[model samples]
Target: MFPQSICAVSMEKTSDQVFQIIALIVLVITSQSQNSCTAKTFTNLTTDESSLLRLKAEITLDPDLTITRNWSSRSSVCSWIGVTCSTRHHRITALNISNMGIYGSIPPQLGNLSFLASLDLSSNYFSGTLPRELSSLRRLKYISLWSNGMKGEIPSWLSLLPKLEYLSLRNNTFIGSIPISISNLTNLYHLDFSNNSLQGKIPQELVGMQRLQHLSIQYNYLSGSIPPALFNISTLRVLAFSVNMLSGRIPNDLCANLPSIERLHLRGNRLSGQIPSNLSRCSQLELLSLRSNSFSGQIPAAVGDLRALQFLDLSDNHLSVYFPTGTLPLSIFDISSLQVLSLQRTNLYGNIPREVGNLTMLISLDLGYNNFTGMKTKGYVIRAFV
Candidate 1:
C-alpha cells in the first residue's frame, strides 16, 4: 500500500511536468507569432512609424477607415493622411483627424512625437484619460479634443507646454477640480473647458495667463465667487461661466480689465446683487447673458449705452422686487442694434416706453411675468411675451 502511495505521488509530479511543458510550448508559439508579425509587417520601422502603428493598434473603431486605410507600412509616414512632417527634419508636426467618428484610447506612445505642434482629435469617440506621457511634448501648441468621452482630472502637467496657444477639451466627462497649475500656460490664447463635470472654485491663478483671449468654463460644477483678478485680463474676448454653482456678486470693476470683451455669459448661477453698471465700458460687447440668477435691483440703464450689444438676457432674477419700483430702464429700448432682449419674471414695473418701437433691429423680446403696465407701439412685428 505504501509503494502504491509513492506511485500516486510520482504520477502527480508527472502531471505537473506535462502542464509546464504545455505552457512552454504555448509561450514559444506566441513569441514566434509576434516575431513573424514583425518580420512580415515592419521593415525596420522608424521611431515615428513605431509610435503611429502602436496608436493604430490601440484604436477600437474606425468608421471611415481613415487611419486604418492610410497608415500603411509600405507608404511614407510623411504622406500619411493626417500627418504633416517638418520640411527640414521630416518629423511629424501636425495631426488633425477631427469629426471622423473614430474611437480609441490615446496610447501613451504618442508622446514620442517630440516635434508635434498641432493635434485636433475633436468630435471623435475617444475615451479614457489623457496619458501623462503627453507632458514630454515641448513643441505642442494647439490641442483640440472637444466632444470626446475623456474622463478624469485635468492634469496639471499640461502647464509644461510652454508654446501651447489653443486648447479645447469641451463637452467631455472630465471630473475633479481644475488644476490651478494651468496658470503657467502664459502663451495660451484660447482655452475652453466647457460642458465638463469639473468641480471646485474657478482658480484665481488664471490671472497669470495674460495672453488668454477666449476663456470658457461653462456647464460645470464650479463654485465660489469668480476671482476679481479674472477681470484684469484686457485680452479676454469671450468669458463664459454659465450653468455653474457659482455664488457672490460680480465685481464692480468687471469691464475695467475686459477692454476687448465681446461676449459675457454668466447665466444659471447663484450670483446675487445688482448688475454692474460698469458693463457699459465694454465697447465691443456683443452678447450679455445673466439669466436664471439671484440678481436684484434695477436693470442697469447703462446697458443701453452698449451700442454694439446684439443680445441681452437678464431674465428669471430678483430684479425690481419692490412693487411700484424698478422702472424698466427706458434707455434699454433705445439700443437700435439690439436683436434679442429678455427680462422675464423680473418684477420690473413701469410703462413700456414708446422708445421700444425704436428698436428696429429687435426681433425677439421676452418681458413675460413682469409688471410692465403697457407696451404701446406701432409698425413692429416683434416676437414678444409682455
Candidate 2:
C-alpha cells in the first residue's frame, strides 16, 4: 500500500514539472516574435533612404550646396534639408526644395518615395521630361514644378495621382493640348498651367472637377471660346484666361454662374459683344479686367453694384456711351474700395464726376485719351491722368 501511494505522488510531481516547462518555452517564443517584428519595422526605412541617396547623385549642381552639404548617409534622412518625415513610421512625407537654384533632371528614383505627399521643385532650373515612374506615387497631394525649364508635353500620367489637390506647372515650356485626362483628379482645387506654350481648346472635361477653385491658363497659345461649362464651376475664385487667343462673347450670365468669383481676367483677347448686365451679381468681385477686347456698346450701369471693386480695367475697348450723356456713370465714383480705375482709350466723352472724391482707397485713375473736359481733381493722392 505504501509503495502504491509513493508511486502516485511521484507521477503528479512529474506532470506539474512538464506543464511549467511548456509554459516557459511559449514565453520565450512570444518574446522573440515581438523582437523580430520591431526589427523588421525599423529596417524598412533603409529602402526609402537608399532611394533618396540615388536622387542626390543625379543632382549635378546645387548652387547653394544645400542638398550636397546636408544630405548625408551619416544621419537620419529625416534631418536632411527639405525633407519632412512622419513621426510614427519615420517615412518621408514632403520634399520642398523650391527656389534652391538647383539644376538637374528629376530622377525616376523619386517614385520610390511611396509615402511622399507634397513635392515643390519650383523656381529651379530642372529640365527634361517628367519620368513615367512618378505615376507610382499614388499618395501625392500637391506638386509644383513652376518656373522650371522642363520641356515636353505635360505627362498624362499625372492624372493617375488620385489625391492630388494643387498642380502648378506654370512658366514651363510644356507644349501640346491640356490633357483631358486631368478631369480624373476630382480632388484638384488649383490648376495653373500659365505661361506655357500649350495650344488647343480648354478641355471641356475640366468641368468635372467640382473642387477646382483657381483655374489660370493665361499666356498660353490656347484658342477657341471659353467653355460655358467652365463658368458653371461655382467654386472658382480666380478665372484668369487672359493673354490667350480666346475669342467670342463673355457668357451673359458669367457672374450669375460664378458666385464665388473674385478676379475675372479676360484681358488681351479678341472677345466681343456687350458687357453682360449680370456683372452686378458678382458682388465679391475685386478685379475685373477686359481691356483690349472688341467689346462695344454702352457700359452697363450694373458696374456700380460691384461695391467690392478695387481694380477695374475696361480700357482700350469700344464702349461708346455711358448713361446720362457726356458724363461717367455716377456709380463708378461710388465704389469705396476702388483702388485702380483705368478707362484709357475708350473714347469716353464726359465730365469727371466730382463724386470721385468719395473713393477713399483710390490710388490710380487713368482716364487718358478720353474727351473729358473740366477735370476737377480730388485732394487725395490719386495718380489721375486725364
Candidate 3:
C-alpha cells in the first residue's frame, strides 16, 4: 500500500499546475489570432438601414404618419419615403423629408450614411442644434433646415465639407455671430442665415467665398460696420443686410467691385453719411433701399446711371440739401425702368419736374410729407405728393 501511494503521488498534478497548462495553450491560440488579423472587418450591419431606423424611432410626432407606417424594417431601405439610392452602388444619396411637420431631433446615427449627398429637413418642427456627428458626412452637399425651431450657434464644422453648395438655416432662433470660418465654403453658392437673432459685425472673411452669389443675413440684430470686403465679392447677386443695428458709413466705393449686384437693401439701420455717388457703377442693380437711415446728403445723380434700377427708396432720411431753394433730383426721372420710388420726408421742396412724367413704368410712388409744390404727376397708383 505504501509503494502504491508513493507512485500515485508522483504521477498526480496540483490544481495550480493544471491551470498553468490551460493558460499556456490559450496564450498560444491568442498569439496565432493576433498574427492573422491585419485589420478588422465589421459586418452584419446595413449602415444606411441602421442609421435611418434609429432616426425614425426618435420622432415624437409625425403629422402624416409617413415615417411611422412606411419606414418598416421589412422593406428595402431604398424603397422608403424621402430616401433615394444610387443605381450602381445601391447606397442612399438623398434624404429630403422637408416640410413634413414632423417633430424630432436629428439622430447622431444619421452620420453613418456614408453616401448621403443631400439632406433637407426644412419647414419642420425639428428642434435642438444640428448634431456634430453630421460633420462625418464627407460627401454631403446640400443641407437646409429653414423655419425650424433649431437654436444655438451655427456649427463651425460646416466649413469642413469641400463640396457643400447650398445651405440655408434661416427663420430659426439661432443667436450669436455669423461664423468667420464660413469663408471656408469655397464652393458654396447660395447661403442664407436671415431672420435669426444673429449678432456681431459681419465677417470680412466672407470675401473669401469667391463663388457666393445670394447671401442674405438680413433681419437679424447684427451690429457694427458692414464689412467693406463684402462689397468686393463681385459674384454677389443679392446682398440684403437690412433691419439690423448696423451703424456706419457705407464705403464710397460700394458699387465699384460689385458688378453682379442686383438688390442692395441697407434700410432701417443707423447708417450716416452721404449715399455713395459711385452707385452708377452697379449696372445690374434693380432694387435699392437706403430708407430709414440717417443719410444727410443730396441724392446722388449717379443713381440715374443704373439702367436696371427699378425700385429706389431713399425715404425717411435727411436728404434735403437746401432743397427749399434747390430743385429735385430730376436725374431719377431718366430711369425708364423705375417702378417704385418712395422719397417720404426727405425734406425736398420744389415744383415737381415734368420729367417725373418720364417714369412710365412707375407703379408705387410715395412722395409724402416732403416740401413739394407739384404739378400733377400722372400714371402712378400709390400717390405722388407735390
- What C-alpha lDDT, on a 0 to 100 scale, does residue 4 get in candidate 1? 92
* lDDT by residue (tens digit), candidate 2, 281-340: 998999999988899887788899999998998888997774444456787778889999
Q: What is the lDDT for 130 in model 1?
A: 98
Off by over 4 Å in 2: 1-43, 322-325, 374-386
lDDT of 1 at 89: 82
- After the best TM-score superposition of candidate 2, give how far the Cα of residue 139 lies from its true spot, in angstroms: 0.5
Q: How well does candidate 1 score on lDDT at residue 358?
A: 85
Model 3: per-residue Cα lDDT over 15-131, one tens digit each: 668889999999999988876663222212387898899999888999999999999889998999999999988889999899899998898988888788999999999889888
Each model's lDDT: 0.87, 0.87, 0.85
Model 2 global lDDT (CA atoms, 0 to 1)? 0.87
Candidate 3 is scored at a TM of 0.84
> Ten consecutive residues with minimal summed lDDT in candidate 3?
36-45
Compute the lDDT of residue 33 as modeled in candidate 3.
82
lDDT of 1 by residue, 1-386 (tens): 56998999999999999999999999999999999987544422277788888889988999989899999988998898888888888788898889999899899988888888999999998999999988878999999999999999999999999999999999999999999889999999999999999999999899999999999999999999999889999899999999999999998778887889999999999999899988789989999999999998877778989999999988889987332333666677778899999877777666656567889998888777766566443212344321
